[model samples]
Target: MADFFRLNKVLIFGVGLIGGSFAAALKAAGAVDEVVGFGRSLPGLEEALRLGLIDRIGESVAAEAPDADLVLLATPVGGMAVLMQALAPHLGPQTIVTDGGSTKHDVVANAYAAFGERVGQFVPAHPIAGAENSGPAAARADLYRDRKVVVTPLPENSSVAVARVCDAWRACGAVLHTLTPADHDRVFAAVSHLPHLLSFALVHDLAVRDDRDMFFTFAASGFRDFTRIAASHPEMWRDICLANRAALLDELDRYTAQLATLREALASGDGAALEAAFDSARTARRAWAEGKLV
Candidate 1:
């Protein structure tokens, strides 16, 4: 099938890892003629250009957005509303607006508030890809390859706009899946957000211990692997946790209950119960890793 949208320019609202990687991937595929990045840091945007991730720096969303056929808001979830409002008047009817946000409900709400009847052009997406490292320097053209990009189109979204966003991700070698904004938040809250919070909590716990230096000195591969996500950008995760607060809190409560059960088992010397719990988790993880479950 032919490409859905051939872009003259793709305006990126943040020139960090996600935005830089998107620009690099699309530029490498020849899907976009130019990638203009709008960001707070001129030096950072310049660095992205120097690395060839973007073609130019955008001085203002009002000025840059008018010329862009597609605008990818790769900013943090908290910043989406402001950026959407800023771009509202500048966006043309033909321009498609999409975002790379971890949480969608708030972003979709921002879209409606900014564009109203023109919300059809706004398609919300969340790319299930990233690394512990961030910034333009950490961007990779193949970051989205084989990664899942979830598209949660609002009711007012035009089919053309949704398809164009899906096609753009596909062009970057990402697999696409569609879900409602609520469903996306619910699933990711349990799988992604909860784990990240656990990781952060674990690290924070260790960091406050009296033997903290000793703990770090002896920390092994297991600790490193388990705490990797804790190293991610704090402000970004903070916004996501708050944006999907209800779902995240529900998942957190369930996880805490499980931990309490395990703790009781350990304290009561209930070896059989502990063994059964461990075995169940081990079996389930094995099945997931072996692709028996999707």
Candidate 2:
């Protein structure tokens, strides 16, 4: 029941939120004919296959690589280097690979190490879309619709490979933008990684308190909104934080500096200084929200 059938066969590595969503989106759009999935859990892969997110369960990367027109490494960043090494040995000439790792520089480095001269076949991308929940059950075909996807293509990547990666994301209704991997990591550290870190830290702080139950009982919308991302996958975020630790640490330092400034303003009873800072942040946030597409 495919329409265009742009990809004869696609291989998915994780079969979780990002991977499941991609497969579902592509299937819904008739963009691909068959999807073969590889993952650590047999039950999870079975669920993905049962949900029609993928057609078959893939065994060996070497066995599957020759037939995969495209491969998506949707696993955590920590696992990427091994996956890259596995695929590098048997990839078809036309098989182009891309990943959903949040930290791009490390992923790009992993590709360089694994692919070497064939590194051009791997295009790096980060989809600016996620939900508190994960796994195949949490995936939906519309997850990436109108979402921003950053593609950090290597200099060695050919135009054709880059175009195909862009087109794949487009098929999921994502808006594509390009950046150097370093810039992508730095920007995401401030906007994405830092926020997740803060959210997780805040939740952890509350959970470890003596009056934790009381805090939970009285928590309201503001707390809920701020800590929503605390519900994200732990191992994935751990890898992201560690992989992009340098940039994340710098952003964290800057954030702590702002916190210190606010604390000083409060201690000095400088309502005006606090108000000025709050107003500036409010205005910038409003402007960003107004122009935001996702």
Name the 10 consecutive residues with the lowest summed lDDT in model 1: 1-10
Superposed Cα deviation of residue 260, candidate 2 (Å) = 2.0
lDDT of 1 by residue, 1-294 (tens): 155446898999888889999999998888989899888788889899999999888877777787778999998888888888889898877899999999988888888999888898899999998886789999999999999999998888888888889889988999999999999999999989999999999999999999899989998999999998999778888999999998899999999999999999999999999999999999998999998973
Worst 10 residues of 2 by lDDT: 1-10
TM-score of every candidate relative to the true structure: 0.92, 0.93
The TM-score of predicted model 2 comes to: 0.93
Q: Positional deviation of 32 in candidate 2, in angstroms?
A: 1.4
lDDT of model number 1: 0.90
lDDT of 2 by residue, 1-294 (tens): 223538899999999999999999999888988999999999999999999999999988888898788999999899999999989989999999999988998999899999999999999999998886789999899999999999998999999899888888889989999999999999999998999999999999999999899989999999999998998878878888999988999999999999999999999999999999999988889888899633
